[model samples]
Target chain A: MAFIQFLKPKNALEEGGRTAAPIQQDAGEPEKTCPNCHKPIPLSRLWSSYLVCPCGYHFRMNARQRITMIADKGSFLELFAGIVSDNPLQFPGYTEKLETVQNISGEAEAVVCGTAEIGGRKCCLFVMDPGFMMGSMGSAVGEKITALFEYAMQKRLPVVGFTVSGGARMQEGLLSLMQMAKTSAAVKRHSDAGLLYIAVFTDPATGGVTASFAMEADILLAEPGATIGFAGARVIEQTTKKALPKEFQKAEFVLQHGFVDTLAPRSTQKQLLTRLLNAH
Target chain B: MNQIPYAVVKLARDSQRPTGLDYIQNIFADFIELHGDRRYADDPAIVGGLARLQDRYVTVIAMEKGHTAKQRSCRNFGAPHPEGYRKALRLMKQAEKFGRPVICFVDTSGASCGIGAEERGQGQAIAENLMELSTLCVPVISILIGEGGSGGALALAVADRVWMLSNAVYSVISPEGCASILWKDSKKAEEAAACLKLTAGDALRLGIIERILPETELGEKPFYDRIRRALAEELEALEKDPDLVPKRYDRFRRIGQVKERT
Candidate 1:
């Protein structure tokens, strides 16, 4: 009897005929949301919507895509591509994860920074990628942002930092936090040069990123349905012990409550950018 | 989230304007605005206007965010970007040299963040302002009107009397970012907000602020009036009691003590 018990599988079903099964019965269908309205629309409609919702809510757009939408076909000249991230802390498994994410994302850091032309107007674009570990800012990210700032100053071009982030990168620890000081200093330098800087807040621009240069833009424009704020909704509710309004972190709510300059629909963002540049 | 001081300026305008123009319209009659850092261009974000408050002449510096789209662009949304901070420091030192008590209205989400601001040394600018503020020979008073986030708020915060309103928030970082870093989730920002303890009540309880001025029950009064009254009482009180400087200094020095083990 003891021998039989030792030979028995961990699960009664394992010993018998039962086999492992998937948790969800409907695994074939995954939810795809409309970028504009944030509604659970089918993938077919999402694709047809041009990445925007029928209601005109804009989905988060990365640097390259934003440039494509703004500039002539392939007008962007990527700069600072040589800069790559290093594992200074050498945290366990971090190097491997970094390499894996880098390879998968085809980028080292969250920001793809360089000088680009949108509608023939020269400007600097620093686009934050939310897909890359939720776009956490590390040393490379900070350096790239600083580089963009420097480039903007040297060229006397306006700066546009399209930001989306999950705050400071935990992997970098103090180094990530130091970026706040670093980026803040860089922004200051640019401001002293009397250059114009416009902050374009994409979906989910929260945390340390928002705390620094993102909030300091001469013109702070947010995408419709984009979340732009320093503190998250949950944090405020937890601290204040009160339920937040439905549109707590939504860009519309922030605009209504005086957090940003304007909420531009995705279709007109390029035009708005050009217009703001002209006004500046 | 902060109210401005249009009422006091209005009253002064009505009483002080020699020929015509209303107080709000002709603020210069009661208060003269000075500009420029002398080293560079004048920053419109920071308004350094010489004002007569309670019959006492004083230098008032307020971080002004624009009310309209054009204004927000002009004032950098009240962030006192690098140049703004520098302009403010210039104002502070000038006020000190003249022996005019410094009254600052802090309403920035934080310092301006731009490439130019970075090149101009945003941190150094803020640090210098903080250092200057800590050692001001004359009385310095600060009030948090809106979003006092991080060193931008701290730079102006070191003063004889620090006050905040009910709806204002002051913190190292906005509560949302704190949560995302700590909990690996931005959705749980509510947890971080509670943890920061950054509301006016918490600040007052911690002795970080001297007092909290309640909004009047006008139920119909303009926010500008509430702001003016709050700022006026503190300004007038400190003006009358010059000794409040040392007491304020001592009060500030006593904050953040830690016991050591032998």
Candidate 2:
């Protein structure tokens, strides 16, 4: 209790800079050279190639891109796109960060939930937007997703959600964590209704997201090269004091460990989904 | 949620596995178990029987909860392995073809997630069941007798009438798992449970389930009569109501829905 200045509006970012951003690092994503290469390719070309730099520096795809690549041609009709969070907890810098991310992504929250078709097969889709404050679940995301599930149930469609997150948004504090339970409950309802839920694990599908619906999919699919697990590998290694497997966190490792149902590459994603839907 | 003697029609919490099947026979006369998915090996964990519920004949598919550690290990603690789900789907399809009402008793913590369960296409099996259950023409009713967690519950839950006892808990994952992953501490499970909204009350409010049968105070005690009485009302009403049967199709589609006001 000694001088723990509860930043009335600022989330208590430790003075040591574990806090997300004060200077707001310029997404250092686009403007970097492929460290593996001596040549510095233009960022646009790298970004256009789904962020795999010419020399193969793998950049993460936000949920929006994932839906576009996987869904049936021109098939996405985004649901619950206008829901937004109000920074009720008033965590320090939460409002600014929320606005900044929202403006950049043109999305209300970390998840874009709606009904779409994957190769003519209908399914409910929830795409987690890492670019939106690292795709953390807050009240808004939960409410939107809950609505999505309700809609899916109403329409009698199967569910497909892609989860990519750094866990609950610390800025939203406890309210953020509450979303985990809310969304999970919604998932239970989906199950009780006997709807097929396909959870797609993308790059770094971690933390609360992994524990809930991501693992709850009737068929859990993961992208190649995606990182998926509960606690981050680094944290687990630190706590257990054990060196983990070389492929411990990658999607391949998850598939090997029996956590993931299958690994899907970006190119053949549409065909794979169609085949699955047909078989089902 | 204990083992059932489908042959004798009795309910007992402690007993042998095959013996429990005898207890079922006591309650249900002329009970004939229908087995095999017709696609793979027969699953003993999930058992279905054609039995007389009073004067009417009904199809009852209940998970055979294992009483012994060896049985539990094989059944994965009442969890229907992939073949179990497959078998349940086959029974429902046959029930539809024969024009018989179906009753599903859910009692497991999600579907099996072990290595063999995965190899046998656990997720695929669950998905197939969901697809078939949604389209089945027969009136289906579900009662949550125990854990009712995740896909295991989902495999048989699409029904015209869905009921849960007072003590059962349902969710995508357990509260302890959620707390540990979300908070990095397992001790916060209580908080996670409260937030999960997974109890019967929350599910009722969500319109995800239709009925909540009464349970004894200190509801941990088994009330087999309560289950029978509630299911009796549902089946009787379904028999009389012409629209009662379409619920299976509607129930499946009425799961997750999200929309934004433009």
Candidate 3:
């Protein structure tokens, strides 16, 4: 059996240039554009607001950057760092694609699962990096998430997961889709232990992930304008042949629909999370 | 066995096909119907209860498509509301708590897509079932009796062993829905069905389903008996296996990860 060397911890990050720095290529654009207002804003203003434009459009952030922004300085301890995918299906060009994304995004996997401190409250955190394969969940991603929930259960700690994905990794086929069931089960076991699980949905949280752990939270929160749903807007529109409301899949739309508990701005997420974790 | 996928899809959707209630009545004994998710109204589409499957007492959950027009409205034509999924999850958790095996009869075209259902957290409800069902320590067996569509079917389909009738069809989306979405023509449902690979045979080949029970021409008795025998064998095997949870977990993990190409 040939195993991909990328599965090794150091090898994945070394091949990817820098693991510590998150993907901020979008910030490098001379005039950071806000999708809502269609206005180019300064990079400094975007970063200061945690990538939420002044006009209220939420820009995407990578996993490491998310942790850095939320977790206290030097308080994040990464777990399941080396367990990367092995193209189990051996799908055509899958390994190459994974390598390319890893190198470009500077992340080992789409999701970063570990422990972090939020306002002195210890919690288990899993942040999905949309830069890498749209933060798709596959075997490696599933394994890391399951491991994190198990760890939380054993340690009797609260869990805080930030979901940002385009859905299951299609390249892995059924393996990727099955992660939905796998991760959800882990979340259930953790919940059964009477531990708190809070999930924060960010931009473009759809597909299998949205159906699973992303929605299996004791307290579900979302960024103000994040797109969250089962089927995409275009598919729903085509199937029903009715023009959808402008805010159809947005976080605020879902909140009004009672799917999410609340919608917070990206800037206040850490503060809100700290309070939720401490209270839980 | 050489039939096209669309024919199987059509057969699976045929109203003449024996539904979940029919199989449950024939296969199990001493059935007691359970209801309500405790958090919402009891959804009639999902019928669950405790029953004796031969000697093993198990929790039985079935998606009912109703026989009459009035019954169809009552059962929502087997399209479960969020409450139905919640009810199934509530019962499955009860079975797990009691160490009883779970048997589900999946016969839904899909989850209810109505506005009321969506407002009630339909996606979250289905997702909760999938997540909780995976970790249930007791063995779970799901039999696809008719149309197993999308996450609705998946909520009940995540089991240690997933069996499908020879004519059953399970897909991510209904053929008409898929056709309309992909080609902007619902009339291309046949082409969509052909491409979806939703037949029992295709599901088995794809590793999504465990086995396909052969359809006998001698009517429903023999078919139900064969399913009973298969269930007995699976339950007995799972009873002996001590690593039930991890074994169940690994069963799904190995799916869609083919080592060598055909």
The numbered model that scores best in DockQ is 3
Candidate 3 lDDT over B1-262, as tens digits, reads: 3247678888888877888888889999999999899997999999999999888899999999988889888889998988999999999989989989999999998777654565677778878788777788899999988998767788998899998888888776676765664466988778767766678876788788889888885236777788888898899999888998887777775554322111
TM-score of each: 0.51, 0.61, 0.79
lDDT of 3 by residue, A105-189 (tens): 7787889999999999999999998777777777788878888998999999999999977666645544565677878878888
> Taking candidate 1, what TM-score does its chain B reach relative to the real chain B?
0.80
lDDT (C-alpha, whole model) for all candidates: 0.61, 0.62, 0.78
Q: Write the per-residue lDDT of candidate 1 for residues A214-268, one digit (tens) a residue.
A: 7767888888777665445554565447666667667887676555799877677
User: What are the RMSD figures for all models against the true structure?
Assistant: 17.1, 10.0, 6.9
Give lDDT tens digits, candidate 2, residues B204-248.
765667877665632222455445566677778787777653454
Error of 3 at A223 (Å): 1.0
Ranking by DockQ: 3, 2, 1
Q: Model 2, A137: alpha-carbon shift in Å?
A: 10
iRMS, candidate 1, in Å: value is 16.5
Q: Best-fitting candidate, measured by TM-score?
A: 3
DockQ per candidate: 0.03, 0.05, 0.26
Off by over 4 Å in 3: A1-29, A86-108, A120-122, A154-157, A241-249, A256-258, B1-16, B29-38, B42-44, B50-52, B55-58, B65-77, B93-100, B135-139, B167-210, B236-262
Q: Please write out the lDDT profile of model 1 over residues B21-100, one tens digit for every residue.
A: 11222222277778887766787777776776555667788777655578667777677765677777787888889978
Worst 10 residues of 2 chain A by lDDT: A1-10
